[model samples]
Target: MKSLGEVLIQRGPFSEIVIGNSAIVRAMLESGVKVVTSYPGSPTPEIAEAINSIPKDKNPLYFEFSTNEKVALELAFGAAVNGYTSCVFFKSVGMNVVADSFVQLSMMEIPGGMVIVTGDDPGANSSQNEQDNRHYARLSYTPIFEPKDAQEVYEMFKKAVEYSRKLRSPVVLRLTTHTAHFKQKVSFGVYEPSPTGEPLFDPNANGPYIPIAQNVPVMKRRALEKLLRWQEISENYAFLQGNGSDVGIITAGLPYLSLLDVLGESAKKVDILRLGMVYPLPRKAISEFLRKHKVVKILEELDNFIEEKVKAIAYEERIDVEIVGKTDIEDWIGEYTPEKVYSVMSKFSPELVRKVEKPVKFVRVVNRPPQLCPGCGHRPVFYVLSKLLREKDISVADIGCHTLGFLEPYKVGQILLSMGHSTGTASGLSMFNKDRKVVAFLGDSTFFHAGLPGIINAVFNKHNFTLVVMENGTTAMTGHQDHPGKAIKIRQILEAIGVKHIWEVDTYQQDKLEEILKTALETPEFNVVIAKHPCMLKFTRERRRKGIIKVPQMKVTNRCTLAGVCITKFACPSFQRADDGSIFVHEDLCIGDGSCMVVCPSGALEFEKIETGGGAK
Candidate 1:
């Protein structure tokens, strides 16, 4: 069987089942995108994975995982400005990091097109927040396209690239969680390989590409002019399906799919306008649709952006229609499902509800909170922190697998804002608290992403705090993607940044880690303790690739006093407590790294080695 990368590059007149992310990759190849860049993030990481799977020799486009979303956007923008079609993508909150540069993108002239793909997480699944990036499209004066499924993900992405080039502006291809992961039989178009070789740059042609105050007004006018042009062309993209007379529903992206699923054959009694280009919406088309129907219902997730825009259009066009949007707060909270849509539509038109299929009854399942994986390296660091830190000490947390430290038993994370903000926040706490010790934890990937500046700030300002750098070797939270940390040493970066006290300790060496962490917390000045360990999952995979079939297993021995420390405080998923108050290692879950043995007060947890083709002994 061919790999996804191999299959994506296949010259087709053929069709295959592909997820939305892979379809976007195919669209990038088909659209002749020369440069591709992204920071690994949820709902969109598969895009990079698919592109990376292709053999480097066969891959046409140049791809890079930049330090952060802003840098990724800048790299792709630079390539696009220098006459190479480029693309950059990241998850919803990643838009926040890219916002500083993103707002300026539309104001600049790009001779070669640039498509900005944002995987907007509507339900907050695998995300910190369900931010609606469609707002950025309006704020930045950039055209935005939202696709319903995998096929449209391919088709609309190709169109977005073309429109970006034509408009000489960056276009936004926004996908929610569902649309990003949705799979369908996507037919392929002829692959248009991107041009190879260095991109040509003529600085003298467009002159200075700076958005200085002198040139600001003109650039703003030009951006608005491009938006106006897009508005005219966008009418063709606004699709009107079904033909109901009394009620009409306006939606975009994943919500449109839910609307269809609930309405089913009964959809013929209602007209649904699905807007492909959500921003700079085709005003003329929306106005005409509003004029035809007596009542129009808008279905969208997270925000009422579409409803507000449509309301404005209706007011301007003098269309007398009852515009219904977000009847309850619940409508704006989560992803729209068939059941959710059915509930909303049933209230609107009782007659049509009976004709359509009733939504399946929801079954309640046990809720399981997320926890660090078995043999996770971060566990030892968090466990040590939990033991050493006093209740009054300020413990700041940054994003990553380490964020789980805030949860039960080991309540280490007291304050958290965003990626890399922990150091900065801890610095503030140290400055104000004065009496209490401040400690912040962040992963290696985040250190490279947004943690460096915070570290520099702490060092420069001479803040009093202990910063724990969990050097897990890879971007573990996002599927173990390779990062700059793999090539560069965290300690070297710390030394170069003028960090005075830096201690490197193995995360699995709990005693040494605890000692180092204890001293670091007592230090009067800014200090860093580098807890080094490979993510167990990544380690296991590497070992398996090296033909090491068996991993050491850990077992709870007779020495266990049933202290519950291993089960409650350490909280390694491998350690479980039965109803009888006896603790044992869940053999199926344990990788046998023996990190848990250090935390057992009674020396109960012991490493039980398994021989080749033999059970653990």
Candidate 2:
């Protein structure tokens, strides 16, 4: 069977329909994107996945799963500077990491095109916060193209790249969760190869590369000039006209789709203006639309970016248009649905609007919230940490699979923040609160990404805390992308970073783990404990791929005592309890990592090799 990657890379005869994310890959391929890189994130992972899925020989683009968002943007920026079209993509919060370099990257002129995709999570669906990155485009002085669906994303991406080259600045492709995840029929287009060839760095081409104090104002002026030029040159614009209704609606991105869904036969009664190019405000186009309508309602998810601007345009242009947005009538938080849009529009057209009944399902099933996967190595670490933690001791957590410790039997992380926030915040807690001990937790990938600075903060300030570094060998949370900390042992990095006292222990070794943790708590100054273990799920798959025989399944023997220590204390998802309150191992779920065997108090769990391709005899 031909893989999705194979279909995406084809030079000709593309599929008739594709998902929103696949369309982005198709767009990249069509545009002859020389380099594609990203830090894996939800609603945007499929773009990189499609590229990585294609065989190296079949795929023309140089694709990389960068260590972090900042590195991904910088890598793509390097490619762009050397005259190769490049793309860097990440989720909403990921932009926070990239923003430092991105702000500076905006000031430079690029010979080759660059497109930065920001997959914003408006509803906080799979994210910690719902951030509006349209402000990033404004802050960076970059033009942004907001695509509504798969087809628009495909078409706008091509335009965005060209505009980036033309404007000599990176263009932001703003995608909400709905737009990126939404599946729709995208008509295929012929691949148009990028004009530039393989990039070769030129030592002599150093004029625009230097961003000294003197060039700061010069770059800012030039960026402003380009923005002014873009307002006129870019033709990828949209404005939906109604049948001369006094009440007009202005929206952009996915919210425009919501407006269309609710308009339903009453569309002719109102004017709708959907702006694809959100930044620069499309003042010329918007002013014209505002003059035609008596009253305009703005519908957008999260921030009222468009609403505020449209109101300003009305005041500046001296157009008599009453703009209503984000008031008691509608909502401003999370995502905008068709029903929400309908409720707002119904105010204008009361007779045309009718509430539609929504279907509800009442099924008797256990609530399955996301948790640590069966036999995850971090499970044991969290289990032990939860056991050892005192009421006075606080656990601070960074972004990773270990964040799951905030739930279930562990219930760690009293203070939760963004990536690398644990260490930074823990440093503050240790310094001010002398009565309590702080235990900050972060993964290997996060240590490299954002935890490094916080570690430094603690060391330099002489704050006392126990930093538990979970070295799971891969970026487990975001699909196990390779990182520097994983490549070079975290111990070496810790030593170099001035971490004098470091203890390394296998997470599965419960006795040693408990002892090491106890020592960490007892120590007065800064302490570090590295929980060294490969993610069990990934390890098992790797072993199977290498043709190694699977380990014997762990089972509950006749000596079973249903004390529930394995279930409550250890809390491995593989442990299941029968209706009679007897404990047993769900053999299919167990990876035979042997953590259960070590922790089982009654010696109930035992590992026995089964007959060839058969159950235990």
Best by TM-score: 1
Tens digits of per-residue lDDT, candidate 2, 19-77, equal 77888888888887788888888878878777788787667788888778999999999
Model 1: per-residue lDDT, tens digit, 1-617? 99888898888867999899999988988888889999999999999999998888889889999999999999999999888999999999999999999999888888789999999987788888888888888899988988999999999999988888887789999988889999999998898564565766666676457778888887888888888898997898899885757789898888787877777677788888989988889998898899889999988888999999899988887889999988887777877877777777777776665334566879998677889999888888888888888888889988999899999878988977888899999888888676788899989999999999999999998888999998889998888888998789899999999999999998888888889999998899999999999898898888889998667789888999999888888888888878898998887888988888877889887778666556445
lDDT at residue 76 of model 2 (Cα atoms): 95
Candidate 2's displacement at residue 93, Å, is 0.8
Residue pairs with backbone overlap in model 1: 244-269, 244-270
**Per-residue error at 246 for model 2, in Å?**
1.5
TM-score of 1: 0.96
Candidate 1 displacement at residue 304 in angstroms: 0.8
Model 1 residue runs over 4 Å out of place are 192-194, 242-244, 354-367, 613-617
Clashing pairs in 2: none
Q: What is the TM-score of each candidate against the true structure?
A: 0.96, 0.93
Question: What value does the lDDT take at residue 281 in candidate 1?
Answer: 90
Candidate 2: segments with Cα more than 4 A from true spot: 192-206, 233-236, 328-330, 343-362, 541-552, 613-617
